[model samples]
Target: MARVCVVGSVNMDLVFAVETLPAPGATVLASSMSRSPGGKGGNQAVAAARAGADVVLVAAVGHDDTGAALRAHLESNNVDVGGVIALPVPSGTASIVVDAQAENVIVVAPGANGHLSLSSPRLRDLVAGCEVLLMQLEIPTDTALAAARVARDAGATVLLNASPVGADPAALAQLAEVTDVVIVNESEARHWVWPVPHLVTTLGARGAVHRSAGGETRVGAPAVEAVDTTGAGDVFAGVLAAGWAADPAHAVRRACAAGALATLVPGAGDCAPDDEAIEDALN
Candidate 1:
């Protein structure tokens, strides 16, 4: 099995299920409150691990209780946490509001995730020996870029998932140059600097478009009512990385299938489906 390395954030998610999202300064009572382990980086790692891959997580958490809990969560999911760092300052957290429709609004505090620089020995070592290196924008851009450079030099397939909006176009292009695969949502597609031949744009239920030097193909999503869209993209990227690690030719197709399967469940990381479930759905 190919080894997967993820360098990103690990956060404790505080979720509130409400009837509706409040307008500016509007006071609305929520129906329920919940906590879950979620971070773009951690989510992807767990997704791949659950899909039966040798997954290693390289990220930072705070020394606070939230960080400890997040670490435990990852370990419980069978993710290799040998590269995780717990910083003494600024623990990671995400405040999420989910409406009855399962629509969510989130605000994240990078806390220790911002402190995860490429200079860390833990990150460097983990990146050195992986088949695929998965990264996201939840961490510092410099750190993300640094990891890309390292993974590229080390001859590992690098995939960049640009999320959370704001990013420099020039930097995005530069990062894409080194990435073997670039997965972006429809909204973020305009940020790419290069005319990538091997790029994927995820378009909700409409499915995804995969373009490369040879040609392009559109993978259709199965018609299914999605209870929660959270982590759907993470599942897309994670499964894609795992499949690519196994066989690059079929990565996009397999990932699109897995992403569709993820919509069958609810919540973020908790919703990611296993490989058999995805294959069953696809077949």
Candidate 2:
């Protein structure tokens, strides 16, 4: 199995299912409400693990019960939580509203995730030893950049999922410089331009495109009814990271399928498909 290290945030997600998302200055009632373990880092780590990778997560949570549950959830999913630290503040949280169409609007409170730093020697070693380092913008950008530098220096492939993109251009640019692959959704792709070694742009339902110095490869997604699209992109990123070392083109195809399958169920990490499910989707 590929050794994948994820450096990012851990949050307890508060999800509300609504008939429609509320506009500014408008209030809407939710049809259902639930809480789950989430956060881009946590979701991707679980996705990678399910895709048959040995995944380790470097993140932070609060000393609260929510934080404990988040760590336990990752552990249950076969992710190594040795690098996860607990801080005095409350854990990060995301308030997500999912519409009937599977579209979502999210607001995040960074909490302890904002305080995540890479000052631990063990965490640095973990990042350096991985075959691929996967990251997102949920944590401190500098921390992600620092982990990327470590992984890059140690000859590991670095993949950055630039989600929730609104970081400083210079910081994002510097991150792209050391990264081997940059993953972004269609909307994010249109906004930020990076001169990275490779770029993977995910088009929901349609498929995904991989562009490198050599050329470009496009893969189509299998048709599926999406129940919730919350963690689909993270699933794509994680599965892509897991399979990228063997074949970029094939990885993109599998990642697309995994992403589509993730939407077949509700919630984030909990809904990620296993290896058999991905192959079943492909066949």
TM-score for each predicted model, relative to the true structure: 0.94, 0.99
lDDT of candidate 2 at residue 138, scale 0 to 100: 89
Q: Write the per-residue lDDT of candidate 2 for residues 128-162, one digit (tens) a residue.
A: 99999999998889999999999999999999999
Give the range where candidate 1 is weakest over 10 consecutive residues by summed lDDT: 190-199
Supply candidate 1's per-residue lDDT for 200: 83
* 98-128 per-residue lDDT for model 1 (tens digits): 8877677889988999899878766787897
In terms of TM-score, the best-performing candidate is 2
Q: State candidate 2's TM-score.
A: 0.99
Task: After superposing candidate 1 on the true structure, give the runs of residues whose Cα lies further than 4 Å from its correct spot.
Answer: none
lDDT of each: 0.82, 0.94
* Superposed Cα deviation of residue 210, candidate 1 (Å): 0.7
Per lDDT, the best of the predicted structures is 2
